[model samples]
Target: MDLLRKSIERVTPLTNEEWKLIVEKSKRIQLKKGEFLQTQHSFVVYECFVLTGSFKTYIMGENGTETVIFFTFGNEWICDLNAFYHKKQASYNIRALEDSELVVVTKPAKDVLFSKIPKLVNFHIHMIEKANIVLQQRVLDLMNKTSKERYVDFIEKNSGRLQKVNNKNLSSYLGISQEFLSKIKREGEVYNEKAR
Candidate 1:
């Protein structure tokens, strides 16, 4: 709950009363690796704040292929925004990549909080803006960047995830074949060794 408070505080200061209200309304949940936090066809009733570990959100295609959309880590929020906002069923799945803890606020609880503390609305807006920017950048990268360029960009921007995330998942997220990703990684290692 303190972590949840800190994450909200990063966006807006909350009064003691507001903090108390939030703590009362949110619930803590734990999930192990391979667990599904939210699956397709379910209603997205809560928005989750990751307290520890990581998660991946993806959609399954008609051909049964899973396309990785994004990864959310500790200190980040994960939800099917459109479904949550529109009161529709989720079109994607969110699954735990590792053993994870999350603080979740239900839609009703969040609405009540917004009504009581209007300023907290800005915090949600800021989160949405950040998510949008990242989504846009990812779309652009996938469309315009070569596989190797995409891999390099991922290494530069998400170095912290390199060791935590497996090659298959990373390659899928980067829209590259696993074989190509391995080749790129091997070549990168060779280049670094020669530079040393």
Candidate 2:
């Protein structure tokens, strides 16, 4: 729990009592590659912090196409905010990209946490603010950026996590087709290699 303690300490220090309360409903779970953390119909009963490995959050279309929304690696939070905050079923899926470990907190426990640790509320606000900024940027990118530009942005942000994601999901996240992503990626890699 030291990692979680450190993550929480970024906003405020936690007392032994406070830490115990926060982790009361938390449990460590493992997900194998391709395992579903939350499916579209699953109840958003918990939110998790990634301890190891990665996951992709996405939605499936009517024709069975998957549109990836985002990826979360170690030290990141993964939750369906819409469903989690509203206490409803998930609208998308969170699937493990590789074997991953997570610390999950049940909604009931989190709902009660705010009252006991007000500092945690501030921490939550910071987390939401950061997540909101990323989401906003994604929307703007989809509206104003070209596919290659988006791919570049993705590389800048994702860095070490790219090799863990397959071409299909990466292209879906970039709002481009697999072939187009491959072309740009090849070109971008060559350009980077030449610069080096």
Candidate 3:
């Protein structure tokens, strides 16, 4: 709950009264590894905050492959906002990579909270805008960057997350094969050794 407050406070400060309203409207859930928070083609009514643990959001491809979209860690937010607000089904799946603790607010509760605390609407907009910008950048990177370039950028942005994900998912995220990812790691090590 503290993390949720901190995440929101980063965008807009919450009054204690408003915080109480938020807490009252939210519910906590614990998910075990391999459990899903939301499955594809399902309605996503809850927008969740990660109190602890790791999760991944992915879509299953036409050819029956899972394309890892993004990973979430502690103190982060995860939700299919478009699907939730537009009253449509989720296009992707959200699953716990490990045991997770999450605080979730239902759409109706969020609406109530937003009406009560107008600043919360701005905070939501800010988060969506921030995600949109990053999403645009990711699309461009996927279209234009080399696998190694993507890997490098991914490492730069998600250093702590690397160890948490398996090679298959990591490679998929970088749009590379596992063998190629291994080759890149070997090359990186050699390059580092030579630089030393």
TM-score against native, each model: 0.96, 0.94, 0.95
- Residue-by-residue lDDT tens digits, candidate 2, 64-108: 989999999999888888788888889889999999999998777
What lDDT would candidate 2 get against the real structure?
0.88
Candidate 2 residue 47 C-alpha distance from true site, Å: 1.0
Off by over 4 Å in 2: none
lDDT of 1 by residue, 86-147 (tens): 88999789989999999988888889989988999999999999889998998999899898
Query: Which pairs of residues collide in model 3?
Result: none
Q: Each prediction's Cα RMSD?
A: 1.2, 1.4, 1.2
Give a tens-digit lDDT track for model 3, residues 78-147. Answer: 8887788888899889999999999998888988998999989889899899889878998999999999
Candidate 3 — what's its lDDT?
A: 0.89
lDDT of 1: 0.88
